[model samples]
Target: MFQDLDATLKALLDDAAGPAELQAADVSFDTPDKDYKPAQATVNLFLHEVTENRTLRDEARVMERVGDGYTSRMPPLRVDCTYLTTAWSAQAGALKAAEEHHLLGLALRWLSRFPIVDDRFLRGSLKNPPQLYPLPTVVAQTQEGRSNGEFWSALGIAPRPAFSVTVTLTVEPFDQVEDLPQVESIQITSTSIPDPTLAGRVLDHALTPVPAVVVTVVETGAQTTSARDGTFIVPGLGFGVYTLSVQAPAKPVEQVTVTYAADHQTHTVVLSGP
Candidate 1:
């Protein structure tokens, strides 16, 4: 009979995590890939965040086609939904939650669904682990009770559209980093957004040692330092206030707070040190 989990034992399980949002079910990318080979055209599925008339987020696309007719005519569907987390679940497996949070972002880079749809999450049970095949996926969402006869119709699918089966993931890969070695006892988690302002050479540049710059998420005050490679990953942040700060001796500490619908939480934070 086991009651409380042993700290030593728990850390041993690399692929296991507890109290995570179970956002393990995020998406399955399929759009319009090349022809499906001998069969015909390839099939692609992409996850998209619905906007007024177009996909506002980094709507990805996976493609699978066969000739002009054959092959699997049906294309994989992209899912872009929200996971409403209270304080409880959000507290568990911080690093994992952070990974899942950023992975959910589709606001930047425009992920290529073609190479990742089949690797998405598709499962009949939410309790069990998810598959690694289907690229796009979803999380085991916790929804409040809904009213009867109240269907969740994509209000914008104008032209009087119909409804059908939307292939969802059995589990979403919200955060796989939870199983990493660096984050064992103390959970390390974060959130993300795509910072488009980081495009030009000015905003993003590499620098050497001298108080390595830290990528501080403008909102959560989360911190991740840059490596010798001048790389840092602050993944899975959400919408709200945030700042990225850089520190260098003999030079003024640089900090910038950003507020944009981040396409992806993982952005290359660069600083030109003095």
Candidate 2:
């Protein structure tokens, strides 16, 4: 993958320098040190740093439909590759500095024209498999807190006029994706809730309204007291048969059975005297 990126950049520079007749200049990826010498004009792109682009990091998995099923895989990892670009000239005296600066300027300007590396210049695996996302480019940007002087000193070479170019690439970590079966059908069921009111009146043996009498449903243990008018109501009753127990002051508890239905009528329970 790294080699593909190197080829892509070389193709891009070669195209850019073609019109200027600078294509004859050699494009080198060699380490520029004290003993390094070039026989002709050269443009060197030294890959110095490679780091993950945290800003473009994605943790979500990508899912795609495949026939009757689906396949899911993790998103590709985005990485930034930084290159220290410099130009070398074999010309002597003042001509050397002028020619090098001119070459560097042309490379910088042409690369800056594209925020993304053009597809026409893509080479190797970059063109074969094709990139998942466009290769983004950053030209002539300052390296974070990195001193060019220190970099050249470490390389045992004198500092030269140059620029930085960064390109972003996506890497797929997982090749095998998980396959999932598609849903065929769905089922839903619902039931109606019972919300009926069981109402009735309490009476004495004399057939007179009897207040202050307790009425209870034996099946559900639901109870209610007779109102001043001898009326009582038990809510939330469903269709079924239930035993009613009635209790009056100083009287024996009386028991009666009643059936609750959709059209249940009011029931009258007669209590015995003490």
Q: What is the TM-score of each candidate against the true structure?
A: 0.22, 0.66
lDDT tens per residue, model 2, 1-274: 8888999898887884454645777888888888778888899999999999999998889888999989999898999999999999999989999989998887888789879989998888888888888999998898588688888989998799989999999888789899887866442322233545777888776667789889989999999999887888888777789999988877878899998766664677877663
How big is the RMSD of model 1? 26.3
Per residue, candidate 1 scores C-alpha lDDT tens digits across 161-195 of 11111122322323322221221233233443333
Cα-based lDDT for every prediction:
0.32, 0.84
Location of the lowest summed lDDT over 10 successive residues in candidate 2: 186-195
Q: Which candidate ranks first by lDDT, i.e. highest?
A: 2
